[model samples]
Target: MPRGKYTNHKGRNRRFTNPEELEEQRRKDEQERRWRQQRGDESSESEEEEDEADKKKASGSKTRGDDDSGSGSEDSSESENSDEEKAKGVSNLIKIENPNRVQKKVKKLSTLNEDLVSQKPQLSRREREEIEKQRAQAHYQKLHAEGKTEQARADLARLAIIKQQREEAAKKRDLEKKQKEEALKAKTAQTQKALGKKT
Candidate 1:
């Protein structure tokens, strides 16, 4: 029944009893109060001051309106004169160009010199084909020397058999799909004819 204690039906106190724990709790509460103030939750004092200033300004404006009714035209004319004077002052002002502004010099880039660029040796079509043929012959000679020609041939045969089997399976699936579609179309035609006869 103490200030910060609670008891259930079992009658056990659910509050910290140690002095250190109470001190820690007080410190935590103080820290939270400071945080709330920083977050603008405790700014009622400043807000009250602002409200008072706003009320004063509103009352002053109402009193000024009652007194200024007779002088409204004069006030408007004075304002116009002030605006014209400001415009005249602006028009009489001289604009001085900055003496320290730098003038940029345009530079012309030099054209590329054909002689300075290194050129790759150009091969004619016949020469390119001959080079390719030589490379192929070299590669074949290397494979033959390594006794891999038979193994490569066997691999190619196996790949061909796999490709042929895949093609045959695809063809069989396509034929079966075509037959099913045709049967569906025939059934639809038969149903339409029977409906027409009944009508």
Candidate 2:
């Protein structure tokens, strides 16, 4: 009634022309907007609640208050200090007054020396054979006294061979023993370095 052409489309023109329809559409749009806004607010509030819970968990874990009385960090360090002090105390106790320990240490040291000596190389195979030959010769002499000349002659021959072998074997064993002594000397030197020659 007022002007030339309604620039809007036919449906839009119809809506604009009817006041009740326009009001109803506006009310629907406002309701949807409010629903969306409410959902956003609820999501943000939930996130804030989660953040607060996480902060509480982090603080609680750092303090370890549930497992220990509120001073967990302090107590652990104190315990470590106490353990070190106890170790020092034990060392001092051992150093200050323990004759029995000293005696035991000396006994152990002597035993170690004996072990080192015993580990030195022993008589050689030839030497052992020579000793066996000597025993056999003695047996053969006894047999000769009992009237066994053939066996005694054989034993005497073996005895001469054994004597020759014994000299060679003795020399070999002496050389091995000397080498063992040298090895022990080197080992002792290393041990002294490690122990710093404590009296």
Candidate 3:
């Protein structure tokens, strides 16, 4: 006699007799309510426009399907032509060019120098310097803790040798550059003298 309960001929209650079914129904109802709420947030005008667009698309697809069914070979050719036209239209609408080729020419001494400058390391210069200083200080402290005073002096001597070697390499490079410039100047002068003699 309950409002939603029905007594079968065997006198069994049939209203939500299965708990799993009741839970499933509740879940479905909840999902539907959420979907409706989401749909309700959009403006009515936008919703109507979307509905009209969908209806038009549905009708168009249905007409295309009917045409394909009515005339098989002709419809297939038309569809292919339409696809090609669509592709052409899209390609015309979106023009793509290579960014590097389009940009201004970059003057660099060498690609190696460009790569070195452009490549970003994980740590910044200041952070790397700080880390190196901390490591060196830790190493010096460890040496002093071990009472190896001579080892610290040897480390300093090694660093001085490294510095001297770097300075010598720089000077050698400068000398080579100067030599190349002088050789170029002499070659030009010889060419000028030969031209004068010929004239």
- Candidate 1 lDDT over 106-144, as tens digits, reads 654443344335556789999999999999999997996
Q: Candidate 1 clash total?
A: 0
**lDDT, candidate 2, 74-183, per-residue tens:** 56874564455454324522224334664434458788889989896788999999999999989877889775798667877899999999999999999999999999
Better of 2 and 3 by TM-score: 3
Model 1 quality (TM-score): 0.25
List ranges where model 2 is wrong by over 4 Å. Answer: 1-150, 194-199
What is the C-alpha RMSD, rounded to one decimal, of candidate 3? Answer: 30.8
CA-lDDT, candidates in order: 0.60, 0.61, 0.62
Question: How does model 3 fare in lDDT?
Answer: 0.62
lDDT of 3 at 137: 94
lDDT of 1 at 54: 66
Model 1 clash pairs? Answer: none
Q: Give the TM-score of candidate 3.
A: 0.25
The TM-score of candidate 2 is 0.22
